[model samples]
Target chain A: MHYTEQSHTFRKIIMTKRITLADVAADAGVSAKTVSDVIHHRGRMREETRERVRNSMRALGYTTNLAARTLRTGSAKLIGLAIPNFAQPFNGNYADIVTSYAWAKGYRVSITTYHRLSQGLRELSADAYRFGVDGWIFLTDTPIPAQDNFLNQDRPVVLTGDYLSHGVADTIMFPNVEASQTATTRLFELGCERIGFIGAPANADSLDVTTQQLDAALTAQEGNSAMRLRGHLTALLQHNRSPLPSLVGACTRLDRSDGEKATLRLLDAGAQFDALFCANDAVALGAMSALTSRGLRIPEDVQIIGFDNTPDAAFSSPRLTTIDPFTEQYAQMAVDCLISRLEGDETAPTVHITDFALIERDSTRH
Target chain B: MHYTEQSHTFRKIIMTKRITLADVAADAGVSAKTVSDVIHHRGRMREETRERVRNSMRALGYTTNLAARTLRTGSAKLIGLAIPNFAQPFNGNYADIVTSYAWAKGYRVSITTYHRLSQGLRELSADAYRFGVDGWIFLTDTPIPAQDNFLNQDRPVVLTGDYLSHGVADTIMFPNVEASQTATTRLFELGCERIGFIGAPANADSLDVTTQQLDAALTAQEGNSAMRLRGHLTALLQHNRSPLPSLVGACTRLDRSDGEKATLRLLDAGAQFDALFCANDAVALGAMSALTSRGLRIPEDVQIIGFDNTPDAAFSSPRLTTIDPFTEQYAQMAVDCLISRLEGDETAPTVHITDFALIERDSTRH
Candidate 1:
């Protein structure tokens, strides 16, 4: 579609003369008021007249100016999603699902990521306002203060991922504790004893706080790694098995490289275990790689399990026995909650709990 | 942040007031024009007065109304990105990188996904205008029409992935042809006389169109899979090797399951091959799984390579040897091109080519 210089200039002149409702009305041989009424879908109009006006508008290349509409209605029909980072596979996948669902509900998504871990929640709140979204969904690992007035100001907010106790925001909490217990019990049922645990090794001291005390305290205050550790310990005690310090590997970050390093550390220290539980699927993958490199046969010599059944879990060698966090359901619930609030639901903030399931694969023998 | 009912009501009342420049000026003890000048940084002002006005604006909780500013300046300071599907790992990672970089440059990102493949490019054009973004960067696999008037109307657009010849939109094409040739040549250098190519096998007929004619023809009309096939054949001919039809495995989709299915069909048909090159990392991962499941040893029995060095590529059992398409750089280039256009660069539509590298790993012997 090569355009001559003269045609390009002509097109520019036409574009500068902005298409208006009056132009469409003139083209359709109708009053400007009738065109305006048809655009807003107000009052009654003949079907033939409405169709003619719409056709004329389309032919004239007229589009409603969104800026003017936003200014008049004070609504952008936009939703803001603030996350720690999308580099993590789980976060990226979640963002994709949420954005798709939101679009179906007639809302566009504006995404922002907090690259610095230290300032995640604070930065999220600040950026949410800058984006000027009608509503917001924030995913954070850090504990947000209860009195964070900026977050609770004017719009509906939904918190996801780790638990948070915000005054005005609804929350959808991941069932980390129950899911972890289920995975650990599954390992025991498979006739594996001396199970090893790999997760946030840096939080070992916090994990030592008895499960009862941890439960009694505000679970929202505890981080994700701490909650998973509690589940592992609770299940171990329930099965009449003691969790030895040597069998537990703590990692600073819950990623593949950290998982491998933590697993190798346990192995080098002469830790003996027949099964291993990891913080997430990434950790499990790294742990599996380390185990294989050391000449250990999976399911025969050791059973392994992980959390967040990511896409790669099913394709990894020996597959992966991991927990499915029900991310799709979580995203739907979060959006539904925000939409309800947007539609003028003034009820108290509710905590929506999501379910989890243990996906059995070749990593563990039945 | 627990808010009392009365406090919530008070906040709602304050929100209804809608802070304006006049309100800020009154609070700062200055004229409305002076406030406007400080907001826009139009002229020099005393540092002390500027600091006082900023503090007053913060105390009064005034935010620049984006809608009004956009209406006046005709710039939204927002960029829209249209992608095929975010569930795909590659697209998700690309979106993440692009969003991060765009944010650093002071532009917010609006993201929309085309769930239905059939209506991807057409729907993208419609949605981009509706979003009212300052500019757009579209990533598409479908062949867009050269004279897509909707896309070329009144905005800067940069197309990514696959070669396209849209007259007004800049293009940042992935180095598919050269990268495929390099991977195929590497297999030959390893002394593999018979190498199998598993990719969009549907392009087999189009692959026969000779490199010269294919290059001379509109490359945009050819899909990515076909271009990759041409590269494979070109490298084979350059090495004085003939590609056998029996050694080619065509896949309907570039996902893991399809890769596995394609590889199985090739194996079940008793195709003799000593090496394999997959279209992308996911397919390569699936092919590795299928090959290993059939009691084949990697490198020793069959060397393999894949494209797009996704995170999983490094963690796969053999740590897949694949091509790095420089997705981060591709994203940066696309965003930079659009930004330059947004900032008043009226030169001809430029075709930007990105570099690719073969990342050696355990999948192929060193």
Candidate 2:
């Protein structure tokens, strides 16, 4: 067999004949079972014998047959992380942290970004199974249905984000309602009334998930915007102020441009507000840009607060005062849950509600 | 054989007897060869037959042995992406773009973040081969040696970033020197003569990587910061303005906090400058934060410009004037190059010098 030499320091010797475990054992003068034990890191072996087997394997350029081993052990040592999108800085940061943590635990992560929110769960499960993923961590805005066969049965899954349904999988929920309430309360403490809300649904009533079935059917915007609005309204009600429908700006996406457009719409509509509560840092940044462009001073003209203390929140002009949803903690918890399940924990599906903190920066400082 | 019912919706059946291709063939009422062809998506089978075979396989819980097939085909259909770090937003965005593009091309990406700059290449190659990666896309600031065995012989690699060394891989250069030159020129055009730089090395002489050997031996800072500094100097020199060594703020990392500290360092050292050019958007954001904290107005006090036109640049207060280094285009080109190589386009290794555009925003506008 003619094998072309690759241009690397390690010469990739393409072989016509497959180098079997028996071949490696023969070269190392050991039994095939001993070679298997060494490969799997199963049984304890003499250091010299292990070294000899490893050396022989390297010499023969032996690559492990992962698929064959997976067939026997039903383990792939691969984790699939499905996110709605990566265009947002928060999602990207979340993925980075999750990947890093998973790597530390001797697992490799295959990231799949679902462009379509509605098809997210289906695509994530299909991709996960196709890639031979042992477990999955799905981060999505849309609520997953409990009847999802993949999430309910085949493999262990850990769901995260503002969505409500666990879909028969363990979930690590973000404290969106609590965080938003705290942010709005802080604005009121700063002497701001008639707070504007950006990145919320057009209808405030849609935020109510009174039943599990309704929660399962919740759209991404409905799930997140509703929770955040509820928080903002609760804060307003607590302050003896009625939630004004006119002050709410509906945004389809949680992006900076969306924030900008939503803020402009509110201003154009002549909505009266002394402060603004942006759904996320991206929206807050955009809102800040819009207000500054319109010659409105942050905290002076309109005190603004945001959610998800993304890296940009700390560096933005006026340095956005945002809610730290404990993203790292959320990611760690999701990973730990998935790992525990993979390690033979047959416990009932768990739901972890992550804690939040208000990161007071220059944007809302009096 | 008795089977234990798993906790999910789909009851996982543990079989005492292993199901084979012959079993699926018999169940589907097809020949074993037909079943094999259907599994591999080869040899042209009817749609009805294909569906039947697929159904039988699913019913019998037959999973394809990818490892066994990989041993025969010598292809894993996987690509490895090695980045310096994901903490920096630029690297995160780059990885996202690369992964998305790779997925569109029917290739899955395994991302590995190399924490240590010095051991980047060695670790990258080891990880790639260990995971049966067909190719690699490495984004690094460190200069790779020209005689790197991984690049010269093994799988094809496409290198991206400010580094000049291509080794045996194709290079997708970011045109850092030219972008920096243009940014500095823009500052001069705004009538600012004394320009301070954040994220450049303290020693200016290290910027000179005139020879291939020198380029190969260049440190991480020299590969990125030095090149950028050279561009700034070239622009200054073109306008008959001598580069002021004192005005340059040296930063160890291209991060927001580092940018802030570097700017403060320059100010404390009494290095007077009317304009600032940041290495990247993150640093520029930090510099902006520091300047604003000091009560200096953007453009009015110290005109500033940044590179990489990251998403934050558009949303930052005073909306950062930046050099759009064509990150998406660069990512696309790198993916294209790798895909071409994977498809057996064994032509001479190519070098792609990406173009840049100056995005004029509030930060540098008069």
Model 1 steric clash pairs = A146-B1, A147-B1, A201-A250, A201-A251, B201-B250
Best prediction by lDDT: 1
Off by over 4 Å in 1: A1-33, A38-43, A47-64, A116-121, A127-132, A201-222, B1-44, B47-64, B116-118, B129-132, B201-222
* Model 1 interface root-mean-square deviation: 6.2
Error of 2 at B109 (Å): 3.6
Error of 2 at B16 (Å): 16
Give the least accurate 10-residue stretch of model 1 chain B, judged by summed lDDT: B5-14
lDDT of 2 by residue, B103-205 (tens): 7887767666566323456555543434456778888766665444445435677888766544466888878788888999889889997998888754345
Candidate 2 per-residue lDDT over residues A66-86, each given as its tens digit: 345554577757777777666
User: How far does residue A305 in candidate 2 sit from its true spot (Å)?
Assistant: 1.3
lDDT of 1 at A49: 83
After superposing candidate 2 on the true structure, give the runs of residues whose Cα lies further than 4 Å from its correct spot.
A1-37, A40-44, A51-76, A116-118, A129-132, A165-167, A202-222, B1-34, B41-44, B51-76, B116-121, B129-132, B147-149, B202-222
